[model samples]
Target: MSSHVAPDDQATSGLDRRGELREFLRSRRARLRPEDVGLPSYGRRRVPGLRREELAQLAGVSYAYYARLEQGYGETMSAEVLDAVARALRLSEEEREHLVRLAQPERQGTPQAAPPPQRLRPSVQHLLDGLGVPAYVVSRRLDILGWNRLAATVFGDWAQLTPEERNTARLIFLSPEARDRFADPERTALTAAGALRMNAGKSPEDSYLSSLIEELSQKSEEFRRLWARHEVSCGTVGDIVRMRHPLVGEFDLVHESMALRGGAPMRLVTYHAEPGSRSEEALRMLASWELEPRR
Candidate 1:
């Protein structure tokens, strides 16, 4: 099979890390009000959220310094300064980490090289085959690497999708079937966007990753809006995903993701229905059904 990387598009090859950091900081600041950070609301403002000078005051930095930082001159910023800005913005733990990543990509580590085609180990595939619940493994890019029989039954057959189409972000944002299957497609979109944003911060130089984000941003307006929010998910585990399976009707399943040890940054994601609930019965029915062989 061919690599999943999109065809070479010079426009989307490299991420503008400084641009990302500036926008992220701006987004975080835009969410807050003068009152939110204990500053008194003053005269009518043209824009939403606290003013730049106000944020500078809150972060205990000069307005000129903060303005430069917001304009993507953060390469020389100290950790203490970044931390202060994070606290001032009232960023969540994941958001804080994301801020550090964007502001100090060099400090974080070397930009990762483009990874080779990902494959699941035989033992990992065996583990999936043995599982009773719907389960799949996904790469750091949210690419579907492997899945079990029940997962295919519950989530639609991944075997039907092209390698590029197997990505979770692509499924959520680009697939018409996903809009119908997900109980809250909007929430799912937000989660997917957040995860992608976090990954982009970590590997700003990854061409495939940059291309995926560009495609999603251009194709999905909802994804574009969510991406602008600058939300980040340190891990993929998210709220209970309520799915409306075509065969089994509607059911809620708790989602969990864990990184596979001693390997690439692949995560094993599993969905389990609450015990003794109608959802469990639905899942059981899916497991019992004889799924058609993969093409």
Candidate 2:
């Protein structure tokens, strides 16, 4: 069936939830194999992941019904049907919620507008300044709003780069040096892309976000490929992150993200190293490398 934009999506949701749902479902489906769901391996399949017929069988629904829903044009989907699909897909809480929103955005409530990324309260800046390790604040669009000296030393000096270059998503996908900074580039990009997807759902009309995505899609082939997968994630375990900083050759760091009080949408992220470890020593070295910003 053709993936036509639903009238409801056109009239109400402006974030392309139909396309999101279609790819999300297909991506999840593609990750599974016949043996994964206890199904016997059958004839050779042209495409990867479980076939539509196989999934339908597992979800206790007809192939036609499953196909239509997968295409993101379901009509009055029952709660039971959704629950069954969730179970079949083995989706986590966030993934299930995302699915529900895409399947029936009409049921979802209107979300609040995200504040300006450049606007940070003085108190929040103080909190960043007080942090011993690398710390920075980010918007839903992943803009680097506020950051301390440590962040500059470790994550690179955003002052030198343009405002758009400071975005985590942009840095991860568009810049090769930034991608090399992370130990697991693929995982980093995938999770960041997922977070961007989640953020787009909430703020569908953000022009900056739209432009950033378009630029990445056009510039980087890998970003375009990963974006097509529709894999989504809120965050990843920061402990797995190993940064190859210029001052410190290789140091493992754990990231901590907190929602500052009165800052509903803005978040502060701090990096920490294990106590008395080599990484910790490297962090100290990084701190020493921090220089005063030019007047």
Candidate 3:
């Protein structure tokens, strides 16, 4: 069957939602084994993971129906049906939401103008400035919309970068300094790519977002590999993030992200170190450098 773009997406941004849906489902299915889902293994399989028919049986749907959906032709699929399929695939919360978005673009209501230029609210800016720790605001697309002085000091002066250069995915994948700054570049890059994938599902018709993904795919082999995994995540639990800063040497900080209310999809991300710790001391010293007179 020939694949087609969703009507809303085509009219707004011409993104290939059908292709995305197919790939996402395939990737999710690929990660599971027959035994993983309480299915008895039979003869040797030609492809990896559960066959389309097996998955259909698990979801209590017809084989042809599931195959059509996999091929990107089930726009009318009910939420109940999708939910059952999600359960059959053992998808995560974020992944299930992503599936619905991809499978039913029309339900997303009126599309925005390919995402207008996101501006940071003054109150949010004030909130970032008031925080002693490194803090910044990021759009759903992972664009660094605004950051505080301490954040600039810790994460490198994003002010020096072009708007496009300030994106988290771009910084992690394409920037050399990012590889050096991150203690685990591979994990960081994967996280960034996964977040990007999540946003892609949310706003598939955003041209700028599509361009960013294409750019990274072309320039970064690592990004290409991670993007193919089709993982979806909005946030991870608080964990110590080690940074190898050129000026501060090295330090660890715990990261937290909160969604900003009454605005476009944006997150307030902050990094803080434990009190009375060596990392805290390093952060204090780093903050003072920003206030020191230029020599």
Candidate 4:
């Protein structure tokens, strides 16, 4: 049986894209000051953001067109115009890509229903087993599909949870144990939101993902607040992450997220502690625990 998207859902999605575009443009504009953009701070401006006219002038586009762009009607804006605007705004690569995705969402096309799960390859499992560090495979939706023993030892034994509960975002927002594992829950939660936003853009018609977001939003006011910000991050924010491990106390570890080759939508994330550090010692203990035979 073929799955299909309802027309009402499509309408709602259109509204969402437009609203997201409006907010993202407004937020980006608000951060830039006139002097920063080399524009004269002629008079005391009451509004916090760059004026539409100023942006239009910067991008070498007409005021009417730029105004429409800011109003979330940039669906027809040319690529060159968008590039100019992105340069004027000094947007990062990721931010620029996100702007394009929101403005020209139709060009990318949305799926009719949720995508099927991408299973981990046996090679990937072997690779994880050979690694010394903690590593796990996760889908774009943050589902912890598969994990090695070391990852299990450091992060909770996720094998205990159902497939739905195994999701990283769900755990971060809904599970007390997961929240407690983070050194700073608020920061991690925000990171989760950004990650989800990025993934959602690539697969907008994912009903399972949509349900996950609704559930999280309903369950967590914090999730709702962060999601409303509409920030999309292409990857992890930093090289290092601070995790509070219940077993070995606190850890400041570096992480690497590698996209699995061979057209898989999953990523393999590995956490490494600096050599000879307390965190490294903790990892050694974790490895030892992994080696212990289960009853």
Point to the candidate with the largest lDDT: 1
For this target, which candidate reaches the highest TM-score against the unseen true structure?
1
Question: How much lDDT does candidate 2 score?
Answer: 0.75
Q: Estimate each model's TM-score.
A: 0.91, 0.88, 0.88, 0.86
Model 3, 135-210: lDDT tens per residue? 9888877888898888888777788888878888889888898678877788788788778777777776677777
* Each model's lDDT: 0.80, 0.75, 0.79, 0.75
Q: Give the Cα-based TM-score of candidate 4 against the true structure.
A: 0.86
Which segments of model 3 are wrong by more than 4 Å?
1-14, 247-249, 291-295
In model 2, the Cα lDDT at residue 16 comes to: 68
Q: Lowest summed lDDT over 10 consecutive residues: which window, candidate 4?
A: 1-10
Question: Candidate 2 residues 211-248, lDDT tens each?
Answer: 66767666767776766766666575464477887666
- Give the lDDT of residue 275 in candidate 4: 95
Question: What does each candidate score in C-alpha RMSD?
Answer: 4.0, 4.4, 4.6, 4.8
Q: Write the per-residue lDDT of candidate 4 for residues 45-164, one digit (tens) a residue.
A: 887868878888999999999888878898899989999999988888878887887788766565343356666778888898889888888887788868888877777878778776
lDDT of 1 by residue, 1-295 (tens): 0011223212276667777777778888889999888899989998899889999999999999999999988888899999999899988888988888878777888867447547789999999999889899988788898999998888788899889899989998888885677888888888887888787777777778877888886787777677767678733465588899878889999888887986567788999989999999999998889887473
Model 2 — TM-score against the truth?
0.88
Q: List the residue pairs that clash in candidate 3.
A: none
User: Which residue pairs does candidate 2 place in steric collision?
Assistant: none
